[model samples]
Target: MEQSNTLLDVKKLEVSYGHVDALKGVDVTVNQGEIVVLIGANGAGKTTLLDTILGINTPRSGSIQYNGTDITGRSADINVREGLTIVPEGRGVFTSMTVTDNLLLGAHHNMHESSDKIERVYQWFPILKERSDQMAGTLSGGERQMLAIGRALMSAPRIILVDEPSIGLAPIIVNNIIEILVNLNKEGYTILLSEQNAYKALKIAHRGYVLETGQVVLSGTAEELLEDPAVKDAYLGA
Candidate 1:
């Protein structure tokens, strides 16, 4: 209940791919212990923003600050080592590897404490433990997502950037994922959730930003966004 500090700050961010602009002067922030949702349609720059922050893509301009340090151009591995990690959109687990092996890959940087980190991840996704020796490619969509998230946790990250977690998932499974995110937030993990399910995203968010064509069109507390007329018609079907 003491969330008051900014953990991640993105200022005037601009990113482009060859000739196409992906993020244009987008400013955003994630406070400690807060679940800040970014609701946008496909190609709205949500993933680009997350990726740019995680160092997957280089930004054309702007600054990315994590815990008050300017890390605009930091490498992904160093960023992960410094407590920032992402659960990519496609649940990019090692399909050929076993569940336990995949999780162990996440602890590559912190292998000195690999066992303890793996145990912590198991507590969050026991199905991972149940399927420890099973190949990741054979797991269901929901289980794969759990492994992706659990794998990120193995790095002992302070901020988790979850990209489109509900993509290709059933309603009940989406609900389960949302609840797991809420629980993770309660356990003190700051999350920046990029989601297309606007209503569901806003429901559990502390604050939210609405992205449109690489720009932030709206932002406010969860309650305000949920009640906004534009939000209802465009996203909630209200």
Candidate 2:
């Protein structure tokens, strides 16, 4: 596939929680309509990086450029409105709300809402449409994951940041979710996925980054990282 143009650029991003550094000068980028995977173990600052980009957590230093505009230090709500959306870790769905309502919250920023986006989400995950009126808490783990991704899509973001998407899901459901994400990428949505499941994540990603203690230790095409002995021993369990 021809490489899409750059959509997001992060240069030497650094974040900290008052004395404990979480991200130390990390450089990452996501191109238009490409799926970029960040694979690392727990506490590697993957989530922190996404949070900083989304403005849920402010960065101590470094710059974030989205579509060539500076977005560092911008509020979370503003970022969402500006076409940057994040489907956070743990599938942060509103359990007490109906599935439809959760999706509406994602579209709150839109001045002219479209039922077509909702319909598209349903088409993507038929189960969500089946449980549209059901409380999110009543849905299965896979259903909740689907709802999370669907809700993010309601915003119609130019880039979607997903953190630990496969965490706490069965292998079959994980495969399903990964396939959906891959399809989304093929449809011209740029995706930045942070995952612990290195093997599965690399399968569909165009490129992969290995984060170690908040730093990018390795980065290459997915096939190259998958074949690396170091990555195989540490993340791939080979």
Highest lDDT model number:
1
Candidate 2 Cα misplacement greater than 4 A, ranges: 1-4
Separately for all candidates shown, the number of backbone clashes (residues 3 or more apart, or on different chains) is 0, 0
| lDDT accuracy of residue 87 in candidate 1 | 96
Measured on C-alpha atoms, candidate 1 has an lDDT of 0.94
TM-score of each: 0.97, 0.97
- Put down candidate 2 lDDT per residue, 71-117, tens digits, no spaces: 99999999999999999899999999999999998898993655888
lDDT of each: 0.94, 0.92
For candidate 2, what is the TM-score?
0.97
lDDT comparing candidate 2 with the true structure: 0.92
Error of 2 at 154 (Å): 0.2
For each candidate in turn, give its C-alpha RMSD to the true structure in angstroms. 1.6, 1.7
- lDDT tens readout by residue for model 1, 87-117: 9998999999999998988877888889888
Question: Model 1, which residues run further than 4 Å from truth?
Answer: 1-4
